[model samples]
Target: MKVTKEEVAYIAKLSNLMLTPEQAEKQAEEFSNILNHFDTINQENLTGIEMYSFEDEPLRLRKDEAIPFKNSDELYANTKSMQETAIKIPKVVE
Candidate 1:
C-alpha cells in the first residue's frame, strides 16, 4: 500500500492539523513506509505454528455497573456554553 500527499492532507484536515506542503510530503512518505512494514509482516508464513491456550473453561468477568459522577456542576463550571447537558465548542468539521 502507498500513501499519497492528498490523502495526508485529507487526514490532516480531519484532525484539525495545519501541515505545509513539505510536511505533508514527509508525512505521506512516512505513512507509506509504516504501511509497507505492516505489509512485510503480513507476508510471513505461520503454517506449522501451534495454538496455545491457558484454560478451556469459560472465562469469568465482573458485572458491568453504571456509576454516576459526584460533582457534575463543578465539572461543567469552566465551560462557556452548555446546551442542557453537553458543553458547546467551536465546530471543527465541515
Candidate 2:
C-alpha cells in the first residue's frame, strides 16, 4: 500500500491543491508511511477484545433555574449610552 509520487500528484490535482515537486515527493513519502502503519495494525490479534460502549454511564446535567434581575437602571448603569428603555450602540453598517 505504498503511495507513489504520481498517485500523490494525481490526488493533489483532484483536490485542487497546488504543491511543488519537493512538497509532493515529501507528502508521498508521508502517505506511504501512514499506509504501512495501517498494514501493521491489520496484522494484530484481537480475538477477545470487548467493543467500547458509552451506554452504561448516566449523563449528569445541571438543573435550570430562573434568577430575577434587580432593575433596568442597575443593568444599564455601565452602558456608554441608552435610549428610552434600551442600550444605544454606535451604527456598525451603512
Please tell me which predicted candidate would have the highest TM-score against the true structure.
1
Model 2: per-residue lDDT, tens digit, 1-94? 8888889999999999888889989999999989988898778898888898668987778889877787978887888888877777778898
Q: What is the C-alpha RMSD of each candidate to the true structure, in Å?
A: 4.8, 10.0
**For model 2, where is the 10-residue window of minimal lDDT?**
52-61
Tens-place lDDT digits, model 1, residues 1-94:
7999999999999999999999999999999999988898677897887777657877788879888989999888888999989878889898
Off by over 4 Å in 2: 44-94
Residue 25 error, candidate 1, Å: 1.1
lDDT of 2 at 2: 83
lDDT scores in order: 0.91, 0.87
State, as a TM-score between 0 and 1, how close model 2 is to the true structure: 0.42
